[model samples]
Target: MIKNVIVGIDPGTTTAIAILDIEGKLLYLHSKRDWKREEIIKAILSFGRPIIIATDVNPPPKSVEKLASSFGCKIFYPEISFSVLEKQELVKAFVYKAKNEHEIDALAACVKAWKRYRSFFTRVSYLLSKKDASELFEEVIKKLLKEGKENVESIVEKMTRKREEPEERVEKPKEKGEKVLEEKEKKLEQAKKELEILTRVLSKRKAELLTYKRIKLSLEELEKCRKELEELKRANNILKRFERIRMKKFEPLVELESINSLELEKLDKLLGLENRVVYCNSLSNANVLNNFGIRALVTECEEEINVANLEFPVIKIEKEFIQDVDGVKCVKEDKLESLLAEVRKSGLIKWLENYRKRKENY
Candidate 1:
């Protein structure tokens, strides 16, 4: 028997189809370009009998309406057209089954229809189980969709009574015929019991299938969270390394591009040259250093600057005494103090004698 199904269609140049059984389980998804009406009908019939035809839009396309008419199935469309984002979300869990946007939209429409009637289907299952007519699940569901709920209760009552009714007994003169009739009734009751058992088994399998789909979706989400956690761990490691570097003591040093009067004047105004160690490439402005309450000078001079009896020390540039911490150039305080001690040991630094000698030569 062809199982009852819901058929969702995307009717366009490239037509797409999605089929779901009455229990909302996915059955088939396909798309074909420029498919004729006859071919579409054939493809749908191959899967199962469609009890309802669904579309994503409120005012469904004429092609979809025609297909529903041809199949004599009920047409289902939402009150408001489903947006792209809504369609995407509806089918996100089953996205892997859809090969294209058309298939996704079709699946979304079918899923929406299933959700609308899912509660009603559950109630039908309950009522049928109460009446011991579980074997009438498919037939009753088909009628419930094609007909109405009120009619379904009466239909179920009639079907159950017909199955339970006993056959007529023959008179005692026809003993052989009576035996044959009794045997036939026994076999019929046994078949009904077997059919009910099969129906229950089918329902259980459908429930298991739904559980598997949910678990698959949960695993996908877990994978995404795992990747995000790894990224956060890597970022934290980098921050920790930077934190360690920041914990070290680093002395701030002001670097001058040139020793010209104007540049030094601007630097002194901006950063206050007082008690500030100034570094420069040349010592041409060494004579002006004492005007500011400068601590010392670090220069790349080949010869020492002989500022006439200047109290401030002049240290030559040493790569070992400099360190760059996070893009800011700084001097090593311990190394600078050791270099200053070595300079002071020479005794007054011979400042005046050297200045006078260099002046006379110039």
Candidate 2:
């Protein structure tokens, strides 16, 4: 008699299969790379006839549906796809450890299907126990599950009654030929059991080897990432050091309340402003500024300063350009250089005009 079993399949580049007995006990679990449909069917048949086929995804895969059709079994799938966490939780209680994700997924799918019909299994078991016909359990369940239309009590009653019936036959003396055939059958059964044990051992070793290869690859990838992170951190540190050096190049501006004869004279005496950049409100004594050897003048003057005659540039600037650092007003060296470039361009034009005029006069 063919035993009824539930089969779970995870199909992909790596296909996995898990089998559970009618009692929800795990009978077999295995996975292979690029397993063909025919190979899978052959492997599943080695366990028993499948009563149900299951998967871990919703909108069941066509491959799984086809497998179920091949077995003439019912298909079971979750309404939503099972998460990684859920799959892990489902398999945690089992003593068997799944070597890879595919195996775990197949096992989880089988467990889910068993849980779904667990109540019906319990009811059938209860009915059989009351009838005192535990031997008919597998036969009755196979009928109820496969047909799904049969009354459970009726099946139990019919099976029990059949078991009670006895058949009468004429007895003949046992022949030596019959004894030899019976011995061969027993030997064949023992050989089949031994082959199954060896296959399980071989599959376990293959799983271990596959797992080791994957772990090695993962370690290599982690090392590569660590090196990249270190390089990034080193680059970031170099940038921070370069920024500190660049900040040192900026000089604090000597603030002037206003730019006039008195202020220019006072600053010249106080700081010796030969090449100092000064900030002020307005330019009053442009002539005096040219004499002091002031490098450039920054101001918030709305009206333009006539710097055509004076050698130094009188640059108009908004308040945003000035940055206060450590209680001192300073401008970034790059920002100051850009402002100076604009001033110099105008100054150069004015100088070129005057030089041409002097040459013409000569």
Candidate 3:
């Protein structure tokens, strides 16, 4: 049923269908006012099977999509919507006469698709018989659609080599030749069955091997992430010990900030921080550290802030207060990114689980 024909459809209140050969010859053309989609599909199939379904509109109407999908043909439309003048100009060379606007539009689409793939069409039609050319054209189109694309000439060349293989020549008496032909035919049928079985087996094994490779990669990533989780758990335990020590140390009440009102001589006893100064970029950073049970000499206040529902001890210091401490250095910028990354790996785990299911099904 494969044929190198282009089918153009002008779908609306009236549906028009046109079929043209690879050489731009019009084989069939018709438009019906009340025809349903099924009737239109049948008329196109009656002429010859089509390789391309053409439409004058970009993002073709649903009627056109149904026809193209039913016929298993690639849909073609101009990148930009074609103007009436452009459609008329394109159709003029293809057909000598047209009864209606639908006919003109359908023929215009057919001509455009024919011209687009004309170079490859000429080579295929010239080198092979019509039947053989039809088969090769169908295969090449399938491959082009499936694999993004392969060069048309390269596909034709490979097919040519396959068809031109040498065949053995034999001579015998007429009666003996008939008997030998029958025996050879029986052997060929048996060989065909064996080839089919082996091909199925090979295809199945290839799929299994691909699944195995994907599963192996997923397992490795999962193990690495598990080890990282184990390390984070150990780090969390260390932070808990810091909290325990802070609870046991010093007075019941401590001066919250290093304000100017506080005396410099009594600063060590007034401030809880033992010669340490910690800076807070915003209120969020304090919330993150406190959630993990870690405490530091914060240089920001917790008063009147509602960022975290569970509040903790946060103190704000004046800009000049840090000058009282010596050898102060800022923390590295990447520490926050590293901490957030460890806490937000649920998405990664979900993705790996999905990948594993897809590979297993394949």
Best by lDDT: 2
**How good is model 3 by TM-score?**
0.41
Residues 1-362, candidate 3, lDDT per residue (tens digit)?
54567998898888788889877788888888988877777777777777889998888888888777887878888998789899888888755767799988988888888888788567655554543554566666645644655466676667666767776565558868898899999999999999999999999999999999899889999999897677667545534544443454411112233323233223333233343333453444344333333233344354555423433334444444332211222322243234335434543576689899999999
> Candidate 3 regions off by >4 Å?
94-96, 127-134, 145-150, 157-362
For candidate 1, give the lDDT of residue 90. Answer: 85
Ten-residue stretch with the least lDDT total in model 3 = 324-333
lDDT, each prediction = 0.79, 0.81, 0.64
Per-prediction TM-score: 0.42, 0.40, 0.41
Local error of candidate 2 at residue 248 (angstroms): 99
What TM-score should be assigned to candidate 2? Answer: 0.40
Note each model's CA RMSD in angstroms. 34.7, 35.4, 34.2
In candidate 3, list every pair of residues with a backbone clash: 300-315, 300-316
Clashes of each: 0, 0, 2
